[model samples]
Target: MTLTQDAAAAEAAAHPRRESVYRPGHPVDIRRTVGMLRRGPGDPTMVFDGAVIWRTVRTSRGAATLALRAVGDEIRASAWGAGADEALETVPALCGAHDDPSGFDPSHHPLIAEVARRSPGIRLARTNEVFDALACAILEQKVTGLEAFRAWRLLVTKFGHRAPGPTPRPMYAAPTASEWHRIPSWDWHRAGVQPPQSKTIVRTAARADSLARAFRAATTGDDRDRVLTSLPGIGVWTSAETRLRALGDPDAVSVGDYHLAHEVGHALTGHRTDDDGMLELLAPWAGHRQRVIRLIFASGVSEPRRGPRLTPADHRRH
Candidate 1:
Protein backbone atom coordinates (compact mmCIF):
# COMPACT_ATOMS: atom_id res chain seq x y z
CA MET A 1 0.00 0.00 0.00
CA THR A 2 1.11 3.59 -0.53
CA LEU A 3 2.14 5.65 2.51
CA THR A 4 -1.03 7.69 2.30
CA GLN A 5 -3.14 4.58 2.05
CA ASP A 6 -1.36 3.00 5.01
CA ALA A 7 -1.97 6.13 7.07
CA ALA A 8 -5.66 6.13 6.21
CA ALA A 9 -6.00 2.43 6.99
CA ALA A 10 -4.20 2.85 10.27
CA GLU A 11 -6.49 5.67 11.21
CA ALA A 12 -9.60 3.70 10.28
CA ALA A 13 -8.43 0.65 12.20
CA ALA A 14 -7.53 2.79 15.19
CA HIS A 15 -11.07 4.08 15.71
CA PRO A 16 -13.93 1.77 14.76
CA ARG A 17 -16.90 2.77 16.92
CA ARG A 18 -17.35 6.35 15.85
CA GLU A 19 -20.00 8.22 17.80
CA SER A 20 -20.50 11.99 17.94
CA VAL A 21 -23.47 14.35 18.23
CA TYR A 22 -21.68 17.47 17.08
CA ARG A 23 -23.86 19.13 14.42
CA PRO A 24 -21.38 21.60 13.12
CA GLY A 25 -21.91 22.97 9.59
CA HIS A 26 -19.28 20.59 8.20
CA PRO A 27 -18.42 16.96 8.78
CA VAL A 28 -15.23 16.60 10.84
CA ASP A 29 -13.45 13.31 11.06
CA ILE A 30 -12.22 13.33 14.65
CA ARG A 31 -10.64 9.93 14.18
CA ARG A 32 -8.40 11.18 11.40
CA THR A 33 -7.41 14.23 13.40
CA VAL A 34 -6.56 12.15 16.48
CA GLY A 35 -4.67 9.64 14.36
CA MET A 36 -2.30 12.35 13.22
CA LEU A 37 -1.18 12.82 16.82
CA ARG A 38 -1.00 9.17 17.83
CA ARG A 39 2.71 8.39 18.02
CA GLY A 40 3.39 4.78 18.99
CA PRO A 41 5.31 5.30 22.25
CA GLY A 42 8.08 7.18 24.08
CA ASP A 43 6.35 10.54 23.72
CA PRO A 44 6.79 12.55 26.88
CA THR A 45 3.11 13.48 27.18
CA MET A 46 1.87 10.13 25.92
CA VAL A 47 -0.84 12.05 24.09
CA PHE A 48 -1.29 9.14 21.69
CA ASP A 49 -1.09 6.27 24.16
CA GLY A 50 -4.66 7.00 25.34
CA ALA A 51 -3.70 9.26 28.19
CA VAL A 52 -4.48 13.00 28.10
CA ILE A 53 -7.58 12.44 25.99
CA TRP A 54 -9.79 14.49 28.25
CA ARG A 55 -9.87 18.20 27.32
CA THR A 56 -12.27 21.02 28.16
CA VAL A 57 -13.57 23.73 25.85
CA ARG A 58 -14.37 27.08 27.47
CA THR A 59 -16.94 29.58 26.22
CA SER A 60 -18.31 32.85 27.50
CA ARG A 61 -20.96 31.13 29.58
CA GLY A 62 -18.93 28.19 30.86
CA ALA A 63 -17.07 25.16 29.51
CA ALA A 64 -17.95 21.94 27.71
CA THR A 65 -16.31 18.52 28.00
CA LEU A 66 -14.98 16.20 25.31
CA ALA A 67 -13.33 12.81 25.39
CA LEU A 68 -11.32 11.21 22.60
CA ARG A 69 -10.29 7.59 22.35
CA ALA A 70 -9.09 5.18 19.71
CA VAL A 71 -11.64 2.43 19.35
CA GLY A 72 -11.48 -0.19 16.61
CA ASP A 73 -11.61 1.34 13.07
CA GLU A 74 -12.86 4.75 14.25
CA ILE A 75 -12.31 7.39 16.91
CA ARG A 76 -14.96 7.51 19.65
CA ALA A 77 -15.97 11.08 20.40
CA SER A 78 -18.40 12.08 23.15
CA ALA A 79 -19.51 15.54 24.13
CA TRP A 80 -21.91 17.02 26.71
CA GLY A 81 -23.81 20.29 27.36
CA ALA A 82 -25.28 23.10 25.27
CA GLY A 83 -21.84 23.96 23.96
CA ALA A 84 -21.30 20.48 22.51
CA ASP A 85 -21.72 21.59 18.92
CA GLU A 86 -19.49 24.59 19.40
CA ALA A 87 -16.90 22.46 21.15
CA LEU A 88 -17.00 19.93 18.36
CA GLU A 89 -16.45 22.59 15.72
CA THR A 90 -13.77 24.34 17.76
CA VAL A 91 -12.05 21.17 18.93
CA PRO A 92 -10.74 20.22 15.49
CA ALA A 93 -9.41 23.71 14.97
CA LEU A 94 -7.80 23.52 18.41
CA CYS A 95 -6.32 20.16 17.46
CA GLY A 96 -4.61 21.94 14.55
CA ALA A 97 -6.65 21.41 11.41
CA HIS A 98 -5.44 24.80 10.27
CA ASP A 99 -1.82 23.71 10.04
CA ASP A 100 -2.47 20.10 9.13
CA PRO A 101 -0.52 18.51 6.26
CA SER A 102 -3.76 17.74 4.43
CA GLY A 103 -3.44 21.27 3.08
CA PHE A 104 0.30 21.07 2.27
CA ASP A 105 2.10 19.06 -0.39
CA PRO A 106 4.84 17.17 1.41
CA SER A 107 6.35 16.09 -1.91
CA HIS A 108 7.74 19.57 -2.49
CA HIS A 109 10.51 19.35 0.16
CA PRO A 110 12.93 16.58 1.05
CA LEU A 111 12.93 17.55 4.72
CA ILE A 112 9.14 17.49 4.83
CA ALA A 113 9.18 14.10 3.15
CA GLU A 114 11.64 12.80 5.74
CA VAL A 115 9.48 14.14 8.53
CA ALA A 116 6.37 12.61 7.03
CA ARG A 117 8.13 9.28 6.80
CA ARG A 118 9.52 9.33 10.30
CA SER A 119 6.56 10.90 12.08
CA PRO A 120 3.46 10.13 10.07
CA GLY A 121 1.22 11.01 12.99
CA ILE A 122 2.84 14.29 13.97
CA ARG A 123 0.33 17.16 13.78
CA LEU A 124 0.28 20.63 15.19
CA ALA A 125 -1.79 20.18 18.38
CA ARG A 126 -3.15 23.73 18.29
CA THR A 127 -4.90 24.29 21.58
CA ASN A 128 -6.70 27.49 20.58
CA GLU A 129 -7.16 27.69 24.34
CA VAL A 130 -4.43 30.26 24.70
CA PHE A 131 -4.69 30.80 28.46
CA ASP A 132 -4.36 27.09 29.09
CA ALA A 133 -1.17 26.81 27.02
CA LEU A 134 0.24 29.93 28.58
CA ALA A 135 -0.49 28.64 32.07
CA CYS A 136 1.11 25.29 31.33
CA ALA A 137 4.15 26.94 29.78
CA ILE A 138 4.54 29.14 32.80
CA LEU A 139 4.50 26.13 35.09
CA GLU A 140 7.30 24.62 32.97
CA GLN A 141 9.75 27.48 33.23
CA LYS A 142 13.21 26.21 34.29
CA VAL A 143 11.59 23.33 36.12
CA THR A 144 11.30 19.61 35.59
CA GLY A 145 8.14 18.42 33.83
CA LEU A 146 7.12 16.43 36.87
CA GLU A 147 7.24 19.58 38.93
CA ALA A 148 5.20 21.42 36.37
CA PHE A 149 2.65 18.65 36.08
CA ARG A 150 2.30 18.49 39.83
CA ALA A 151 1.70 22.21 40.09
CA TRP A 152 -0.69 22.13 37.16
CA ARG A 153 -2.68 19.28 38.62
CA LEU A 154 -2.90 20.95 41.98
CA LEU A 155 -3.92 24.31 40.58
CA VAL A 156 -6.58 22.83 38.33
CA THR A 157 -8.08 20.65 40.97
CA LYS A 158 -8.17 23.39 43.53
CA PHE A 159 -9.12 26.44 41.55
CA GLY A 160 -10.49 25.26 38.23
CA HIS A 161 -14.16 24.52 37.57
CA ARG A 162 -15.35 21.00 36.86
CA ALA A 163 -15.64 20.23 33.18
CA PRO A 164 -19.22 19.72 31.91
CA GLY A 165 -19.47 16.34 30.21
CA PRO A 166 -20.51 12.73 30.45
CA THR A 167 -17.02 11.31 30.73
CA PRO A 168 -16.49 9.00 33.71
CA ARG A 169 -13.31 10.65 34.79
CA PRO A 170 -13.31 14.11 36.33
CA MET A 171 -11.55 16.60 34.04
CA TYR A 172 -10.76 20.00 35.50
CA ALA A 173 -10.97 23.06 33.36
CA ALA A 174 -7.74 25.02 33.22
CA PRO A 175 -8.09 28.30 35.09
CA THR A 176 -9.20 31.22 32.95
CA ALA A 177 -7.25 34.44 32.64
CA SER A 178 -9.33 36.12 35.31
CA GLU A 179 -8.87 33.22 37.67
CA TRP A 180 -5.15 33.19 37.05
CA HIS A 181 -4.89 36.84 38.03
CA ARG A 182 -6.84 36.15 41.22
CA ILE A 183 -4.51 33.35 42.34
CA PRO A 184 -2.43 34.73 45.19
CA SER A 185 1.28 34.23 45.70
CA TRP A 186 0.65 31.95 48.66
CA ASP A 187 -1.64 29.81 46.57
CA TRP A 188 1.00 29.50 43.88
CA HIS A 189 3.64 28.61 46.46
CA ARG A 190 1.31 26.03 47.94
CA ALA A 191 0.94 24.64 44.45
CA GLY A 192 4.74 24.30 44.31
CA VAL A 193 5.47 27.27 42.07
CA GLN A 194 8.53 29.40 42.60
CA PRO A 195 8.32 33.16 42.82
CA PRO A 196 9.80 33.77 39.40
CA GLN A 197 7.52 31.36 37.55
CA SER A 198 4.48 32.58 39.43
CA LYS A 199 5.32 36.16 38.62
CA THR A 200 5.67 35.34 34.95
CA ILE A 201 2.33 33.55 34.88
CA VAL A 202 0.54 36.41 36.60
CA ARG A 203 2.04 38.96 34.26
CA THR A 204 1.25 36.94 31.15
CA ALA A 205 -2.26 36.09 32.32
CA ALA A 206 -3.08 39.77 32.21
CA ARG A 207 -2.74 39.64 28.44
CA ALA A 208 -3.42 35.98 27.74
CA ASP A 209 -6.52 36.64 25.66
CA SER A 210 -4.82 39.30 23.57
CA LEU A 211 -1.71 37.21 23.01
CA ALA A 212 -3.78 34.29 21.83
CA ARG A 213 -5.48 36.49 19.26
CA ALA A 214 -2.08 37.77 18.14
CA PHE A 215 -0.90 34.21 17.60
CA ARG A 216 -4.00 33.47 15.57
CA ALA A 217 -3.21 36.45 13.33
CA ALA A 218 0.45 35.49 12.86
CA THR A 219 1.21 33.56 9.67
CA THR A 220 5.02 33.41 9.64
CA GLY A 221 7.59 32.35 12.20
CA ASP A 222 8.84 35.90 12.65
CA ASP A 223 5.34 37.23 13.09
CA ARG A 224 4.44 34.70 15.77
CA ASP A 225 7.77 35.14 17.55
CA ARG A 226 7.44 38.91 17.58
CA VAL A 227 3.94 38.81 19.09
CA LEU A 228 4.77 36.16 21.68
CA THR A 229 7.93 37.95 22.80
CA SER A 230 5.95 41.13 23.32
CA LEU A 231 4.51 39.60 26.46
CA PRO A 232 6.54 39.73 29.67
CA GLY A 233 8.58 36.58 30.56
CA ILE A 234 8.14 35.22 27.02
CA GLY A 235 11.45 34.81 25.20
CA VAL A 236 12.66 33.30 21.93
CA TRP A 237 12.68 29.77 23.31
CA THR A 238 9.22 30.02 24.84
CA SER A 239 7.79 31.64 21.72
CA ALA A 240 9.33 29.03 19.44
CA GLU A 241 8.22 26.21 21.69
CA THR A 242 4.67 27.51 21.84
CA ARG A 243 4.56 28.25 18.10
CA LEU A 244 5.55 24.66 17.33
CA ARG A 245 2.21 23.52 18.73
CA ALA A 246 0.19 26.73 18.58
CA LEU A 247 0.94 27.72 14.98
CA GLY A 248 2.36 24.48 13.65
CA ASP A 249 5.30 26.50 12.42
CA PRO A 250 7.48 24.31 10.22
CA ASP A 251 10.63 26.41 10.78
CA ALA A 252 10.24 27.42 14.40
CA VAL A 253 13.50 26.04 15.75
CA SER A 254 13.83 26.28 19.52
CA VAL A 255 17.08 28.23 19.87
CA GLY A 256 17.28 28.37 23.67
CA ASP A 257 16.28 24.90 24.70
CA TYR A 258 18.10 23.17 27.51
CA HIS A 259 18.48 19.75 25.82
CA LEU A 260 17.64 20.28 22.13
CA ALA A 261 21.22 21.31 21.33
CA HIS A 262 22.64 18.08 22.70
CA GLU A 263 19.90 15.99 21.16
CA VAL A 264 20.26 17.60 17.74
CA GLY A 265 24.04 17.31 17.93
CA HIS A 266 23.93 13.64 18.83
CA ALA A 267 21.45 12.88 16.07
CA LEU A 268 23.28 14.84 13.35
CA THR A 269 26.84 14.07 14.44
CA GLY A 270 28.66 11.51 16.60
CA HIS A 271 29.15 13.80 19.59
CA ARG A 272 27.32 16.50 21.49
CA THR A 273 27.25 20.01 20.07
CA ASP A 274 26.48 23.46 21.33
CA ASP A 275 23.53 25.57 20.16
CA ASP A 276 25.71 27.10 17.42
CA GLY A 277 26.76 23.68 16.12
CA MET A 278 23.17 22.49 16.10
CA LEU A 279 22.14 25.58 14.16
CA GLU A 280 24.98 25.11 11.70
CA LEU A 281 23.99 21.52 11.01
CA LEU A 282 20.35 22.49 10.56
CA ALA A 283 21.10 25.57 8.47
CA PRO A 284 20.64 23.58 5.28
CA TRP A 285 16.98 23.19 6.18
CA ALA A 286 16.47 26.76 7.34
CA GLY A 287 12.90 27.00 6.09
CA HIS A 288 12.02 23.65 7.62
CA ARG A 289 14.38 23.38 10.57
CA GLN A 290 11.61 22.47 13.01
CA ARG A 291 10.41 19.76 10.67
CA VAL A 292 13.94 18.33 10.54
CA ILE A 293 14.17 18.35 14.31
CA ARG A 294 10.84 16.56 14.61
CA LEU A 295 12.03 13.92 12.13
CA ILE A 296 15.28 13.34 14.02
CA PHE A 297 13.32 12.98 17.23
CA ALA A 298 10.65 10.76 15.71
CA SER A 299 13.41 8.62 14.18
CA GLY A 300 13.74 7.26 17.74
CA VAL A 301 17.45 7.99 18.05
CA SER A 302 17.97 8.46 21.77
CA GLU A 303 21.09 10.15 23.06
CA PRO A 304 23.13 8.03 25.47
CA ARG A 305 22.46 9.28 28.96
CA ARG A 306 25.45 9.98 31.22
CA GLY A 307 23.53 10.99 34.32
CA PRO A 308 20.29 10.54 36.22
CA ARG A 309 17.09 12.30 35.21
CA LEU A 310 16.56 15.73 36.62
CA THR A 311 14.65 15.59 39.88
CA PRO A 312 11.71 17.91 40.33
CA ALA A 313 11.97 20.27 43.30
CA ASP A 314 9.06 21.17 45.55
CA HIS A 315 9.49 24.83 46.24
CA ARG A 316 6.85 24.76 48.94
CA ARG A 317 8.91 22.29 50.93
CA HIS A 318 12.07 24.25 50.26
Candidate 2:
Protein backbone atom coordinates (compact mmCIF):
# COMPACT_ATOMS: atom_id res chain seq x y z
CA MET A 1 0.00 0.00 0.00
CA THR A 2 1.13 3.58 -0.61
CA LEU A 3 2.61 5.56 2.32
CA THR A 4 -0.04 8.24 1.84
CA GLN A 5 -2.85 5.69 2.24
CA ASP A 6 -1.19 4.13 5.30
CA ALA A 7 -0.77 7.55 6.98
CA ALA A 8 -4.40 8.48 6.32
CA ALA A 9 -5.60 5.22 7.84
CA ALA A 10 -3.41 5.77 10.90
CA GLU A 11 -4.77 9.28 11.32
CA ALA A 12 -8.34 8.10 11.19
CA ALA A 13 -7.62 5.42 13.76
CA ALA A 14 -6.10 7.93 16.16
CA HIS A 15 -9.09 10.26 16.07
CA PRO A 16 -12.65 8.89 16.00
CA ARG A 17 -15.57 10.95 14.71
CA ARG A 18 -17.86 12.29 17.42
CA GLU A 19 -21.48 13.41 17.86
CA SER A 20 -23.71 14.25 20.82
CA VAL A 21 -27.48 14.41 21.13
CA TYR A 22 -29.28 16.67 23.59
CA ARG A 23 -32.25 15.24 25.49
CA PRO A 24 -33.52 18.29 27.33
CA GLY A 25 -36.47 16.58 28.95
CA HIS A 26 -36.21 12.95 27.91
CA PRO A 27 -34.86 10.73 30.63
CA VAL A 28 -33.38 7.74 28.86
CA ASP A 29 -31.03 5.32 30.57
CA ILE A 30 -28.70 4.42 27.74
CA ARG A 31 -27.49 1.27 29.47
CA ARG A 32 -30.91 -0.15 30.34
CA THR A 33 -32.21 0.54 26.86
CA VAL A 34 -29.31 -1.00 24.94
CA GLY A 35 -28.63 -3.78 27.44
CA MET A 36 -31.29 -6.01 25.81
CA LEU A 37 -29.12 -6.43 22.75
CA ARG A 38 -26.39 -8.06 24.78
CA ARG A 39 -26.66 -11.84 24.55
CA GLY A 40 -24.84 -12.59 27.79
CA PRO A 41 -22.38 -11.08 30.20
CA GLY A 42 -19.48 -12.39 28.12
CA ASP A 43 -20.89 -11.09 24.85
CA PRO A 44 -18.02 -10.07 22.54
CA THR A 45 -20.01 -7.37 20.78
CA MET A 46 -20.92 -5.28 23.84
CA VAL A 47 -19.53 -4.27 27.21
CA PHE A 48 -20.48 -2.04 30.11
CA ASP A 49 -18.22 0.06 32.35
CA GLY A 50 -19.97 2.12 34.99
CA ALA A 51 -22.07 4.68 33.10
CA VAL A 52 -20.41 4.06 29.72
CA ILE A 53 -21.44 1.41 27.19
CA TRP A 54 -19.38 0.23 24.27
CA ARG A 55 -20.43 -1.94 21.35
CA THR A 56 -19.44 -3.05 17.90
CA VAL A 57 -21.92 -2.93 15.04
CA ARG A 58 -21.90 -4.00 11.41
CA THR A 59 -23.34 -1.19 9.28
CA SER A 60 -24.09 -1.06 5.56
CA ARG A 61 -20.78 0.68 4.95
CA GLY A 62 -18.64 -1.47 7.25
CA ALA A 63 -17.92 -2.36 10.85
CA ALA A 64 -17.77 0.36 13.58
CA THR A 65 -17.06 0.65 17.27
CA LEU A 66 -19.53 2.88 19.11
CA ALA A 67 -19.14 4.26 22.60
CA LEU A 68 -21.96 6.00 24.45
CA ARG A 69 -22.13 7.81 27.77
CA ALA A 70 -25.07 9.66 29.20
CA VAL A 71 -24.47 12.88 31.04
CA GLY A 72 -27.22 14.95 32.73
CA ASP A 73 -29.31 15.86 29.66
CA GLU A 74 -27.37 14.60 26.67
CA ILE A 75 -25.84 11.40 25.39
CA ARG A 76 -22.28 11.67 24.14
CA ALA A 77 -21.53 9.27 21.26
CA SER A 78 -18.42 8.47 19.32
CA ALA A 79 -17.70 6.03 16.49
CA TRP A 80 -14.70 4.68 14.68
CA GLY A 81 -14.22 2.67 11.47
CA ALA A 82 -15.44 2.79 7.90
CA GLY A 83 -19.03 2.92 9.05
CA ALA A 84 -18.49 5.61 11.66
CA ASP A 85 -20.78 8.08 9.95
CA GLU A 86 -23.66 5.65 9.69
CA ALA A 87 -23.23 4.55 13.28
CA LEU A 88 -23.27 8.15 14.51
CA GLU A 89 -26.44 8.85 12.54
CA THR A 90 -28.27 6.08 14.43
CA VAL A 91 -27.32 7.37 17.88
CA PRO A 92 -30.78 8.74 18.64
CA ALA A 93 -32.71 5.60 17.79
CA LEU A 94 -30.13 3.43 19.49
CA CYS A 95 -30.63 5.51 22.62
CA GLY A 96 -34.42 5.05 22.38
CA ALA A 97 -35.34 8.41 20.88
CA HIS A 98 -38.12 6.91 18.77
CA ASP A 99 -39.57 4.62 21.43
CA ASP A 100 -42.71 6.49 22.39
CA PRO A 101 -44.78 5.42 25.38
CA SER A 102 -47.73 7.74 24.67
CA GLY A 103 -50.47 5.09 24.78
CA PHE A 104 -48.98 2.95 27.57
CA ASP A 105 -50.94 3.10 30.80
CA PRO A 106 -48.86 1.29 33.37
CA SER A 107 -51.62 1.96 35.94
CA HIS A 108 -53.62 -0.99 34.60
CA HIS A 109 -51.72 -3.10 37.16
CA PRO A 110 -50.37 -1.93 40.49
CA LEU A 111 -47.13 -3.91 40.19
CA ILE A 112 -46.53 -2.55 36.70
CA ALA A 113 -47.42 0.91 37.92
CA GLU A 114 -44.90 0.77 40.76
CA VAL A 115 -42.16 -0.67 38.57
CA ALA A 116 -42.76 1.87 35.83
CA ARG A 117 -42.76 4.66 38.37
CA ARG A 118 -39.41 3.62 39.74
CA SER A 119 -37.85 3.15 36.32
CA PRO A 120 -39.07 6.03 34.20
CA GLY A 121 -35.95 6.09 32.01
CA ILE A 122 -36.47 2.68 30.47
CA ARG A 123 -37.13 2.78 26.72
CA LEU A 124 -36.83 0.11 24.05
CA ALA A 125 -33.60 0.31 22.06
CA ARG A 126 -33.41 -0.14 18.28
CA THR A 127 -30.24 -1.30 16.53
CA ASN A 128 -31.72 -1.00 13.02
CA GLU A 129 -29.40 -3.81 12.00
CA VAL A 130 -31.75 -6.65 11.21
CA PHE A 131 -29.28 -9.33 10.11
CA ASP A 132 -27.26 -9.17 13.33
CA ALA A 133 -30.39 -9.34 15.48
CA LEU A 134 -31.88 -12.17 13.38
CA ALA A 135 -28.69 -14.23 13.43
CA CYS A 136 -28.41 -14.03 17.21
CA ALA A 137 -32.12 -14.65 17.66
CA ILE A 138 -31.80 -17.82 15.60
CA LEU A 139 -28.92 -19.00 17.77
CA GLU A 140 -31.07 -18.55 20.89
CA GLN A 141 -34.00 -20.57 19.55
CA LYS A 142 -35.00 -23.67 21.51
CA VAL A 143 -31.79 -23.75 23.55
CA THR A 144 -30.61 -22.73 26.95
CA GLY A 145 -29.10 -19.21 27.06
CA LEU A 146 -25.74 -20.62 28.17
CA GLU A 147 -25.60 -22.83 25.09
CA ALA A 148 -26.71 -20.06 22.76
CA PHE A 149 -24.24 -17.53 24.20
CA ARG A 150 -21.38 -20.04 23.96
CA ALA A 151 -22.10 -20.72 20.31
CA TRP A 152 -22.43 -17.00 19.58
CA ARG A 153 -19.13 -16.20 21.31
CA LEU A 154 -17.25 -18.97 19.54
CA LEU A 155 -18.60 -18.19 16.09
CA VAL A 156 -18.29 -14.41 16.30
CA THR A 157 -14.82 -14.28 17.87
CA LYS A 158 -13.62 -16.56 15.10
CA PHE A 159 -15.41 -15.09 12.09
CA GLY A 160 -16.18 -11.42 12.88
CA HIS A 161 -13.98 -8.54 11.90
CA ARG A 162 -11.82 -6.92 14.58
CA ALA A 163 -13.34 -3.65 15.85
CA PRO A 164 -11.31 -0.64 14.63
CA GLY A 165 -11.10 1.68 17.66
CA PRO A 166 -9.80 1.62 21.17
CA THR A 167 -12.30 -0.37 23.23
CA PRO A 168 -12.47 -1.47 26.84
CA ARG A 169 -11.47 -4.93 25.68
CA PRO A 170 -10.98 -6.85 22.47
CA MET A 171 -14.29 -6.65 20.61
CA TYR A 172 -15.63 -7.84 17.28
CA ALA A 173 -18.69 -7.07 15.20
CA ALA A 174 -20.93 -9.88 14.00
CA PRO A 175 -19.98 -11.59 10.76
CA THR A 176 -21.61 -10.34 7.58
CA ALA A 177 -24.53 -12.37 6.22
CA SER A 178 -22.45 -13.92 3.46
CA GLU A 179 -19.81 -14.90 5.99
CA TRP A 180 -22.47 -16.36 8.28
CA HIS A 181 -23.84 -18.49 5.43
CA ARG A 182 -20.35 -19.81 4.66
CA ILE A 183 -19.64 -21.10 8.19
CA PRO A 184 -18.87 -24.81 7.80
CA SER A 185 -20.99 -27.47 9.45
CA TRP A 186 -18.09 -28.76 11.56
CA ASP A 187 -17.37 -25.30 12.93
CA TRP A 188 -20.98 -24.97 14.07
CA HIS A 189 -20.89 -28.37 15.70
CA ARG A 190 -17.70 -27.52 17.51
CA ALA A 191 -19.39 -24.37 18.76
CA GLY A 192 -22.07 -26.64 20.33
CA VAL A 193 -24.79 -25.40 18.01
CA GLN A 194 -27.03 -28.23 16.84
CA PRO A 195 -27.63 -28.74 13.15
CA PRO A 196 -31.13 -27.26 13.23
CA GLN A 197 -30.12 -23.90 14.64
CA SER A 198 -27.09 -23.64 12.40
CA LYS A 199 -29.12 -24.52 9.32
CA THR A 200 -31.65 -21.80 10.13
CA ILE A 201 -28.88 -19.23 10.34
CA VAL A 202 -27.53 -20.35 6.97
CA ARG A 203 -30.92 -20.05 5.30
CA THR A 204 -31.60 -16.70 6.90
CA ALA A 205 -28.18 -15.39 5.92
CA ALA A 206 -28.84 -16.11 2.26
CA ARG A 207 -31.70 -13.65 2.20
CA ALA A 208 -30.36 -11.15 4.73
CA ASP A 209 -30.46 -8.09 2.46
CA SER A 210 -34.01 -8.56 1.26
CA LEU A 211 -35.10 -9.56 4.74
CA ALA A 212 -33.69 -6.33 6.23
CA ARG A 213 -35.55 -4.21 3.71
CA ALA A 214 -38.80 -6.06 4.26
CA PHE A 215 -38.53 -5.81 8.03
CA ARG A 216 -37.84 -2.07 7.86
CA ALA A 217 -40.70 -1.43 5.46
CA ALA A 218 -43.18 -3.47 7.48
CA THR A 219 -45.84 -1.20 9.00
CA THR A 220 -46.89 -3.34 11.93
CA GLY A 221 -45.47 -5.92 14.29
CA ASP A 222 -47.73 -8.61 12.78
CA ASP A 223 -46.60 -7.71 9.28
CA ARG A 224 -42.95 -7.97 10.28
CA ASP A 225 -43.59 -11.29 11.99
CA ARG A 226 -45.27 -12.65 8.88
CA VAL A 227 -42.34 -11.70 6.70
CA LEU A 228 -39.84 -13.23 9.11
CA THR A 229 -41.75 -16.44 9.84
CA SER A 230 -42.45 -17.07 6.16
CA LEU A 231 -38.79 -17.99 5.86
CA PRO A 232 -37.98 -21.60 6.62
CA GLY A 233 -37.02 -22.27 10.28
CA ILE A 234 -38.00 -18.79 11.49
CA GLY A 235 -40.91 -18.93 13.94
CA VAL A 236 -43.05 -16.67 16.08
CA TRP A 237 -40.65 -16.47 19.03
CA THR A 238 -37.67 -15.74 16.85
CA SER A 239 -39.61 -13.13 14.89
CA ALA A 240 -40.69 -11.43 18.10
CA GLU A 241 -37.14 -11.36 19.43
CA THR A 242 -35.82 -9.93 16.19
CA ARG A 243 -38.44 -7.19 16.22
CA LEU A 244 -37.72 -6.29 19.83
CA ARG A 245 -34.04 -5.71 19.16
CA ALA A 246 -33.95 -4.57 15.54
CA LEU A 247 -37.15 -2.61 15.18
CA GLY A 248 -37.72 -1.73 18.85
CA ASP A 249 -41.32 -2.88 18.50
CA PRO A 250 -42.81 -2.38 21.95
CA ASP A 251 -45.73 -4.74 21.16
CA ALA A 252 -43.45 -7.68 20.36
CA VAL A 253 -44.02 -10.56 22.72
CA SER A 254 -41.93 -13.70 22.77
CA VAL A 255 -44.95 -15.96 23.11
CA GLY A 256 -43.15 -19.31 23.02
CA ASP A 257 -40.38 -18.57 25.48
CA TYR A 258 -39.71 -21.37 27.92
CA HIS A 259 -39.78 -19.34 31.14
CA LEU A 260 -41.32 -16.01 30.16
CA ALA A 261 -44.97 -17.07 30.50
CA HIS A 262 -44.34 -18.55 33.89
CA GLU A 263 -42.30 -15.59 35.06
CA VAL A 264 -44.85 -13.02 33.94
CA GLY A 265 -47.71 -15.00 35.42
CA HIS A 266 -45.90 -15.58 38.69
CA ALA A 267 -45.01 -11.94 39.00
CA LEU A 268 -48.48 -10.70 38.21
CA THR A 269 -50.84 -13.41 39.55
CA GLY A 270 -48.64 -15.22 42.13
CA HIS A 271 -49.04 -18.44 40.14
CA ARG A 272 -47.53 -19.97 37.04
CA THR A 273 -49.44 -19.67 33.77
CA ASP A 274 -49.19 -21.00 30.23
CA ASP A 275 -48.42 -18.94 27.14
CA ASP A 276 -52.13 -18.33 26.51
CA GLY A 277 -52.63 -17.10 30.04
CA MET A 278 -49.59 -14.86 29.85
CA LEU A 279 -50.92 -13.32 26.64
CA GLU A 280 -54.28 -12.74 28.30
CA LEU A 281 -52.64 -11.06 31.28
CA LEU A 282 -50.60 -8.83 29.06
CA ALA A 283 -53.50 -8.12 26.70
CA PRO A 284 -54.69 -5.15 28.72
CA TRP A 285 -51.51 -3.28 27.75
CA ALA A 286 -52.03 -4.14 24.05
CA GLY A 287 -49.53 -1.93 22.22
CA HIS A 288 -47.19 -1.83 25.19
CA ARG A 289 -46.93 -5.50 26.08
CA GLN A 290 -43.17 -5.67 25.60
CA ARG A 291 -42.71 -2.56 27.73
CA VAL A 292 -44.68 -4.20 30.50
CA ILE A 293 -42.60 -7.35 30.15
CA ARG A 294 -39.43 -5.30 30.44
CA LEU A 295 -40.69 -3.65 33.60
CA ILE A 296 -41.44 -7.06 35.12
CA PHE A 297 -38.00 -8.38 34.28
CA ALA A 298 -36.33 -5.26 35.58
CA SER A 299 -38.30 -5.56 38.80
CA GLY A 300 -36.43 -8.82 39.50
CA VAL A 301 -39.58 -10.83 40.12
CA SER A 302 -39.51 -14.54 39.35
CA GLU A 303 -41.24 -17.74 40.37
CA PRO A 304 -39.82 -19.72 43.24
CA ARG A 305 -37.51 -22.43 42.02
CA ARG A 306 -38.98 -25.86 42.75
CA GLY A 307 -35.92 -27.69 41.48
CA PRO A 308 -32.33 -27.22 40.43
CA ARG A 309 -31.81 -25.29 37.22
CA LEU A 310 -32.02 -27.45 34.13
CA THR A 311 -28.61 -28.31 32.72
CA PRO A 312 -27.89 -27.35 29.15
CA ALA A 313 -27.68 -30.27 26.76
CA ASP A 314 -24.24 -30.55 25.24
CA HIS A 315 -24.66 -31.54 21.60
CA ARG A 316 -20.89 -31.64 21.07
CA ARG A 317 -20.69 -34.80 23.14
CA HIS A 318 -22.75 -36.66 20.61
Pull out the clashing pairs in model 2.
none
Model 2 lowest lDDT segment of ten: 15-24
Per-residue lDDT, model 2, residue 63, is 79
Regions more than 4 Å wrong, model 1: 1-52, 70-76, 100-115
lDDT by residue for model 1 over 1-318, one digit each (tens)?
999668545644543222363232333334333433322222121133244365566666565666765444333456554455566665555444565343344454454466566555454556565666666766777887677777887787677766654445556566788798889889999988998888888888888778788888987888888987887777888777777655567677888778899998887776899889988988767666776676676667668999999887667877
- lDDT, candidate 2, 31-95, per-residue tens: 78987789898889999977878889788777788889888888888888888877888888887
Return the top candidate by TM-score: 2
Prediction 1 TM-score vs. true: 0.76
State the RMSD for candidate 1.
9.8
Q: List the residue pairs that clash in candidate 1.
A: 12-73, 15-73, 15-74, 15-75, 16-71, 16-72, 16-73, 16-74, 36-121
